[model samples]
Structure formats: C-alpha cells, structure tokens
Target: MPVRTADAALAGVRRGVGAERLTGRTALVTGSSRGMGRAAAIRLAQEGALVAVHYNRDEAAAREVVTSVEKDGGRAFAVRGELGVDGDVDGLFAVLEEDLRERTGSTDLHILVNNAGVMGGVGADEVTPEQFDRIFAVNAKAPFFLIQRALRNMPDGGRIINISSGLTRFANPDEIAYAMSKGALEQLALHFAKALGPRRITINSVAPGITRNGNPVFDIPEVVEQMAGLSAFGRVGEPEDVADVVAFLATDEARWITGSFVDATGGTLLG
Candidate 1:
C-alpha cells in the first residue's frame, strides 16, 4: 500500500478500537474561558468526556464556552476559580463537587488539565519579589494544590496534564520569572507521576511554543510572522493543535503514557 494510504488505515483502526475512549469520563480544564484552555475543554467534550469549564475572572466568557460545548451535544458547565489563591481554589472545588453531584451523583473526576497560566517577561533587574511570587503562585503552586485536590477525587486511570512552555527548554532572556515558573511545573509533572503511580493515575506536561490568540503579543503581523519562523513547520500553532494532543491524553488509549512531556510546540524545540 502507499505510505499515505497505510497511515490512513492505521488511524481508522485506532479510532474504531479505542474503546469509546473517554465516554462517561469527567474532565476539569482550568483557565478555559478562552484560548488554549477553551479549545482543550471543547475537544475533550467532543471526544465524549463531560468537561468542567474553568475561568478565573471572565464569567461571561466561561459561560460562553459552556454554552458552545452544550450546543455541540457535549456536557459542560462554567466554574470560577482564581488559580493563585487558596479561597478561590477551595470555593471552585465546592462548586465543582455540587455540580458533579447534580450531574452524575458522584464526586469522582477523571481528568484534570492544568491549563491556566500568565505570561509576562521582565528583565532580571526589573523583576520584583512580588512579581516572582505571583508568577510561581499561578504557574506552579496553584497546579500543585489543584492536582492534590483532583487526585482525591480521581480514580485509577485518571490523568493530570500540566500546560508548560517551550521557554523551559530554550532560554528567553526577558522571561526570567515566567521561565522559572514553567521549569517548576515540569518538575511537578515528573514528581506527581511518581507519587500518583501507585493509584494508576498518570501525570504529564504539554509544552507549547508561541501561538496566536487574542493576546497582544501576537497582534502585530511582523511579530506573528517571526514566531512562525521559529518553528520547523514554519507556522505558529493553533489552539486546536494543542487540544488534539490533550484530548488523546485524557483517553484510555494513552493509559500507559505517563510521566512524559509531550511537545505540542510545532517543532520549535527542534534544531
């Protein structure tokens, strides 16, 4: 058979045999009001998992995501939470627990995607202690505690996917604090995988390169073009690109894949 034809056949087989992969599963995706998080939540729901659409401050945006998911015949609801704060995290869980009970009569969660993050690059000299602390609180500490809370409600075969960045591998001179925070997240994935292995829970990280959203960084045509050039694919990635991988990870098809960092970076880390 031709290579392309053979590849197509294999893909069909995988899809057909994947066991209704994520059907009846429940997922939580933080920072899902827009961008990558929103894409991931929708993808997971499309793949048959009930999704919890999480947002920090954008209630309307979060509701919009939920509405879109439901319109597509998927299960989803907006849940508000501030990633870097304790009270907000606790309250988020409380609401999630209640929602879960109403929907499925169970508090168990199957997948947790730590997709919330903030990016602000400052020179080392300009980085203040407060700035560093906030970055860590959101990018590192929040995920840690969220994972801890998730594991309590997750059963065997559950998954935890942390969203990291390419900066962890390549140095960005101006992103001192942001890079450091992602580095910490990378470590958390490895250690959490080990810690959760006994329960058959898998933990991993998905690191992305510069991608366009409504963010100002990608607003300039020249800057967008420059970002595309950084990748071997010669194009910046789309939210859907990252979402596809995350949806797969949440399925039983990836049960054996754990403690790994999957690069959805459009080959930006490639030399």
Candidate 2:
C-alpha cells in the first residue's frame, strides 16, 4: 500500500501539527550540497525542522540548498568544515549551535544525518595506506565524533541517521576500502543504538544501492544499465528515493525503529 500524504492521511495533523513533529526540531546534514545529503536536508525542512546544511568545499552549492529551503517556508543555514579533522567537527557543531539559537532560540540539536562519504576505487593490491586512511577518516571517524558532539545537544528521543552503501553487502573488489568504511559505520550504528537506548535516542543506518546522483561511478551507460538491472525494481535509485526513507526515519512514526540497517537499496541485494 502506498503511504498517504500528510494532508490526505491525517487532516488533523495537517491542520494543527505544531512544528513539534519537526517545528522546533533542528537537524544537521553533512555533505548536503548535493546528492543524498541535499535531498535529505530539503526533506527535513519541508517537514518543519530547521536545517543546518554542511558542505566540505562547496560554499555556493551549500548556499543554494539553504536558499531553496528558505524559499519553501523552512529555515536553514549553511556551515563549512572538513569531516574528520580534529577541530572540524567542533567547528561544524559550533555553527550549528549558532544557527539553532538564531532560529529556535536554543542550541538543542534534534537530528544528525552523517551523509558525507567518499568512494575509493582502489583494489586490494592497489589500495594505499593513505587511501584507506582517507576513506575511513570521512566515512567512519568523522561520523563517530560528530555523533559524540550531537549527543551533547541532543536530549532524549534524538535521531541519528547514518548513510551507508550497499557495497558493504556485495563487497566489490574495486571498492574494498569504501565498503569496509561503510561496514564499520553499520557496526557503529548498532553500538550507538545500544549505548543511547536508555536515553531513547535512535541511531540507524540507511544503505543505498547504485544511486545515479551525478556521481562519476554511474557515468558509463553500460555501467548504469548494469546497476539498474541489479535492482529488483529494474531502475537506478534516485536521491529522493533515499531521501524519503531518511525523512520517514526522522519522524515520530519511526519511534520504534532503531539500531537497525534499513536497506533503501531498491531491492538491489535481493538477487
């Protein structure tokens, strides 16, 4: 069955659901200048949450997202910081704090979406120490520390959503390092879920399949067709496809779901 829109499903919720479902809520989405991060940030703002759009080096793209969010009657701001640096995580949160205070009069962060990642194409034999370190630094280390920082401002019922890749399950030889990093993130999700369970905070990972988000991986027509065929749905995944799942997980509707890896991979792993 298809899910109904807020307007069609619950008239009462649409009529007077004060931003509590997301109104006063604040969210931080890293790598949100484009792709999955951009989609997720916009979706969160549409649902009433104030958004903090974080980008690594794309100031213009980040600002564009913030502008789009604001144009839609949502509140958003952009922050720049490299993931995995010692003070970078702190700087990102510091900006988040400032944005939250300016928008909601509080520094309380309610949602943290660790969506920044890099794919390493090095095979096992070609994988360099630097390549491995770089992938893990962004995919694993940055998210772990960001979670630690998010927890300080996140009270009970806070949400932490991590983005992983379906490569972790298929384990392609070319993306060993990237897969490994994502696999570690899945494990981190489980651990954080257990650690934060007592406080009612939810931590989960969303693994995407071969999503054609203007990434170089899908540049070749043959490769794109192969990826489309890999999914049981017979199509490549879209950013909005994954964004919808992320938005669902952020809602009160997903209160019972946590410590889990929800495969938003369009049935790519089924075959």
| Candidate that would win on TM-score | 1
lDDT values for all models: 0.83, 0.85
Tell me the tens digit of each residue's lDDT in model 2 across 35-121. Answer: 999989988988888888999898999999999988868788998889866787888878778878877889999999999999887
* CA displacement after TM-score superposition, residue 180 of candidate 2 (Å): 0.8
Residue range 1-271, candidate 1, lDDT tens digits: 1111112333423231234468888999999989999989988888878899998888999999999988877789988877787675778899999999899999999999999998767888888888888999999989888887887899887999999998988888899789899999988878888888888888899998876567786667677767777787676777777887888888777889888988888889577
The local lDDT score (0 to 100) that residue 3 gets in candidate 2 is: 21
Q: Model 1, 253: alpha-carbon shift in Å?
A: 1.1
Residue 156 in candidate 1 has what lDDT?
88
